[model samples]
Target: MNGDWLLLGRDGRLSVYLPSDGAALWRAERAPAGPWEAPRRIGGDQELLPGLSIGRGPDGYGHLVAWRPVGTDRSDLVHTTHFRPLLAPLDWQPAGHPNKQGARTGTPAVAVDAQGRAHVFVRNGGGGMSMVAQKEKGGWEPWRDLKGRGVQEEPAAVTGESGRVELYAAVTGGIRHWRQEQPGARPVPGEGVDAAVRPGTLRALATSEESTTVLFTDDDSGELCAWRPGEKPMPLVAAAGPGPVSAVRCVIDGHDCTLVAQRSTSGRVAFAAYPSQQEALGAVWTESGPELPADAVVSLALDADGRLVAATLSPSTGQLRLARRKDEPGLALGPWQAV
Candidate 1:
């Protein structure tokens, strides 16, 4: 469910207005950052994947970053810094880290570690290569290109049960795993990259202190899939076609909650909920009303207290709606507001 009324504009601008007084709070430009002052237009035919994603860290800080367009060759990477509210106007700075060989590096994924430092993993388009970069002390570390094969993309990270940060990346063939190097420790391989799973996009859900689950659609059949920490990746639910999956989050505040918002082939936004991650992949799932969007860029987030918030482009009127999860049935959208 939406907390405040947000107006999602058709021009790709999200105007988050205050619900109480209908005053705009923040308006973020959905554009690509480049060479200090240059503003490059992102997300088009040249750029297969849009160069932006937003996430709130565990410490309640908003993190945002963008990947410089590598054209079709996937080289020439210029990843931006993980910006927070503290550095106004100059919130996003250059990461100051790049591949030594510079084999056309881009498609960087950012995850905040338990200590508040950001961990970025970039994939090389030349030979399905991967590299890990971390911010430490007062500067960013040199890129550590791990030896591996497969088109590594969509890296996901979380502080594991042991407090050590763990990272997962989707491989062209399957999935690869990595952790902060400890002397001579080696990286591991995750489950096979199910051909059914889509490339470059996977939504991860932290189920428990000991387990993490990732959700994606099968590349072949477009069926939904769920992969737990140590379990084999398998089919979760079946879908019509392979459309982008909108942010999947598990809202657990002493209450069992799981919600995944995805778009169907018809351009309608759908929501799926479960008692837990277990139930979501099981035989049953509770879904919300269809929010048909014309442009199809949707995002969802859940508060620490289990309140569901979704933002999407409405297909009918081209408005951005910030809807919340109504405990009842039949589109009882309170907080039924626009941005």
Candidate 2:
């Protein structure tokens, strides 16, 4: 099967790589009140890895980021705007030596803060996490190391309520967290939260306000775990399953909410929603649909029509599948159809 790949744009459009040809594919609704549009290829030949990221700046333009290998030991962090015709390259490791085989490097994460600036975080070839921010007018600041070792997955980032940017990633024994209060401000180091999360399983979502929610699979038990600002990491559910998770903050039924999706032990994908950050810590999870394949990698998002959408990679067929929640009287997820 193809590697896990996905990009949820700020405009509620979901993009995924076609397994057959490695082409970029996107699906979205035509309008807020319109029907869902069929999935279509977006025109690209690059074979993207699992942790692709997409974000929209204040200018109403979307930015996509991914890592492209240029040589045996080097990979360039490439990005392109929604309106641009070509990808722009960003050197991830200017001074570090080329990465030999079997060395772990993290995927890139990008988020746009309130000031209309884009912030990017990625693991360098030297095994340290680094960050860079876009200038107000145009261009990027020099890369600054966040100083962590053994980061083998993509870092999680969010633009907080007060316009602060917070980043988190799995370190040696726990997760490292960092925050920048304002644009171009120095990053403040925070205490690492203790947890045995599996490498590459951590994902986070930030509200428009002050709280952040982190999700991961426990390395030992394989159960889903969550962490908020002050509270310690807690298990969202007790059963062990394949620990793929994705989260997003969106307005549901006219109320702001955080939605989290995880694979359950029964092979079905389940989802939970909290009206606010305070309620998420104690909220109950609701199962979305029938059993997906046990080995499927799942990604979740809300469509422009405000419907919950799920994309799954079928292990046996090596194809991508799309499913949606039927807005009937109850919470019913539709059957998975080939994209």
Candidate 3:
């Protein structure tokens, strides 16, 4: 969602969080708009694993989680936060490893609940999911098992409109899921839907105030499919993209829409817009723009002006690049710019 990377802060400014020597940030020079600033590393000497997971709490702090390599082999998850009036974040705090020996597989997922606690999830070295959340007063709870093996990739976690969270992991046979028993409480097992999904393509978007729908490419055919926990997976397109898809809900041409995009086989970003929950109606796909630096993490969000905007890390330049939906009725994106 918004906080995952290109965050629209409470102050109405935009902050693009990019992974770097630790992590980097690019905040809009002006609120509600940006001639973005040069990249600023969050200032830790630690080397960060390739991806980052950020959750913006209700209080406006951006809680960040990522894998920190411990020595040459083992690694542990670390945490940090950034907020207004402070461009530099607090020091990286060790959130600890899931395995007593250390967790080495899967990326971390972060989501902040209504009560302002940040929750982190990852597939552990034990071949199961592990989670850690903020305790009532502060700090983090010990890593606990959510229990599921064969997790294909990084799990997807999202907070519903109610501030409760649900996590989904694409596994060997189907989808594995967990949901908070109540807002801010520990998550419990939930019904899972059987489906064949590609690893690392799993993404969850809240389709309604109370429910979330996950999107992923079909493992066997590369088709994009969407599903809620109890429903059968619904195909959204005959073929999707080569990488994980990113989604954001917005109003397009006066109609409520869910816009999705990913790196296509041609190496450029491909996108589609469909009425929410109406994927059965059909998704018209469009290919646009040049390919990002290989393995770029793409993120989309509606600006305060309510326009579609996307940002991706440019590993080649070690900076951030951006593109916005053009001022046309269709899925046209203006030229990309290094921010």
Q: Please list the C-alpha lDDT of all candidates, in the order they appear.
A: 0.48, 0.62, 0.77
> lDDT (0-100) at residue 295 of candidate 2?
68
**TM-scores for candidates 1 onward, in order:** 0.69, 0.75, 0.91
Residue pairs clashing, model 3: none
Per-residue C-alpha lDDT of model 1 across residues 1-339, encoded as one tens digit per residue: 111112222232323321111111233434311011112222222222244434334454444444433435333333333232222222334453345443334445555565655555566545444544445564566656565566554556554433345566676656656664342232344444444457655666566666666666767766777777556776756753355555444544444656666655665566655555564445333344454654445666543334556766543344555566676543234453554
Q: Candidate 2: where are CA atoms >4 Å away?
A: 1-51, 56-60, 83-104, 250-257, 278-286, 313-339
Question: Candidate 3 lDDT, tens digit per residue, 250-289?
Answer: 8778887899877667667678999988889878778776
Weakest 10 consecutive residues, lDDT, candidate 1? 16-25
What stretches of model 1 exceed 4 Å from their correct place? 1-50, 69-89, 96-98, 101-104, 125-129, 159-163, 180-195, 247-255, 279-291, 313-319, 327-336
Instruction: Give the higher-TM-score candidate: 1 or 3.
Output: 3
Highest lDDT among the candidates is held by which one?
3
Error of 3 at 39 (Å): 0.9
In candidate 3, residue 312 scores what lDDT? 72
Scored against the true structure, residue 151 in model 3 reaches a CA lDDT of 79
